[model samples]
Target: MSKVAIVGVVGRTNAGKSTLVNRLVGEKVSIVSPVEQTTRNTVRGIVADPRGQLVLLDTPGLHKAVGTLGTLLNRMARRSAAGTDITCVVFDASQEPQLEDVGWMQRVAKEAPDRVVFVLNKCDAKPFFSSMFREAWKEASTTPQPSPVKPVWVDCCALTDDGAKGVMDALFDFAQEGEPLFPEDVVTDYPRKLAIADTVREKFLSKLHQELPHELGVRVKEIAEGNGRWAVAVDVLVNRPSQKPIVIGRSAQTIKGARKAAEKELSEVFGVKVSLELWVKVEPNWMKNPKILEEMGYMGAVI
Candidate 1:
């Protein structure tokens, strides 16, 4: 018999949740960005250890919602934590705790205090405050939790993959012995279309910085496969006509750079040669469009 568990990786925005999941999976299942809420979907990154397997759900960081899309993402993140067998919260130790971090602790303290793990990420940077966080959690948990045991705490550097194994180890201890949920040799089960869109959006986000990371979206419209090569077409979505030129850039340089970089990275990630094309389309408030949100995998298809 083997052991298996579904571990929910949750944290506040820009908490390195995606990076740690990719490290644990040993592959790029989720995209990483310096911008907040880079992960807008619930991505399952499976980790196979000699002990068993852990299905890690890389969820969007919990944040204040400005629109319907933002609300959906926050709900997904909270629901992921509520449904999983274990909850692992990643905190950026490089900075002090924020309100969202306290919010998570409060919820988990009242809900599943014992079945939690605190990952003090960015331990590579100094001035560690893991002890302070632990004490805070104790105060938060003791009131509502019924004689809860302390949650496991691990120091990790998600950037360099340092001390991440310890997080997996702690999870394994909590994982019950059972049959494996996923086969070996599979890193993630995320949809291919969404993955491709994420790759393209990642490059776009890298290039544009603070300008449009929050408003724009990516959708892979078509994929043609033949002769061991893939032809992929993607749409860059913005809210208004005015934002179109920014995505296309001066003389199309930004779009071209984003396309070239996306194609190269996607080729490596998917383990196949890819020919990619991009188009910028204006979708006025597409985030509120249920059909568009469904197509983007932000929600299940409407019945």
Candidate 2:
């Protein structure tokens, strides 16, 4: 039996956590977008190799919890680090590491001092954000450590596939020796319902403006599988009425575009013809509403 490995990928919002996972798995198990806080849940991507199997926990970026959802996401990221054999602390080489980044890493490492690896991502740094990260890393290197796990630097570019294999090798080195964590054919454990919902939400973020993207949430209201096609219905939840127009766009173009893109992607994910039904709902302050949050699959939203 191959050794089992749980590698936790951690970093700030928009630091390419999902992209890196896609690279290792060689498939798009996790959604990737330019928007920050794009991921609000812990997604698992399983990568199988000849020697062993690597089970990766691609978590929401470590950040301050603004409301119910943010708090839960932050908790999820921290909790993801607690029991994992390798805690990969990812950062974008494009931007300087802020105090928040260094501070979060320190605290997480306090929980598992020996397992943290500092991953400086986006090494294909487009000039504007290139030089700034060195200063950031210098700051991190000097930041007082609460425990013995000093952050180790590893650079990678998910889009270009640069230095990514190194990151995988490093993760393997840190993983515990045991049997393969999952069967070879299984790439991710996300339930079809939740995965489709997340896919819809991901498309929303990718296509919508920054300010409005975070205000949106998606839920799969119903799904039915037919002979040659799967029928799926999803509710697009927004916190306020004003944001609806932005998502819907002029003549509802934006909403229609988002739905088409989502349907295409979800079809590929399920490997069949997909009939997607989309509806918009105004869930006043849903981000702060416990019931709504729980219904959205954020069971830990109250943390």
Residue-wise C-alpha lDDT for candidate 2, range 41-157, written one tens digit per residue:
788899987768888888888766788788888888878866777778778767776665766655654555567677778888765354455455554545665345555567787
Worst 10 residues of 2 by lDDT: 127-136
lDDT of each: 0.87, 0.77
**Model 1, C-alpha of 94: deviation from truth (Å):** 1.7
| Displacement of the residue 8 alpha carbon in candidate 1, Å | 0.6
Off by over 4 Å in 1: 143-149, 301-303
C-alpha positional error of residue 207 in candidate 2 after TM-score superposition, expressed in Å:
2.0
The alpha-carbon deviation from the true structure for residue 141 of candidate 2, after best TM-score superposition, in angstroms, is 6.8
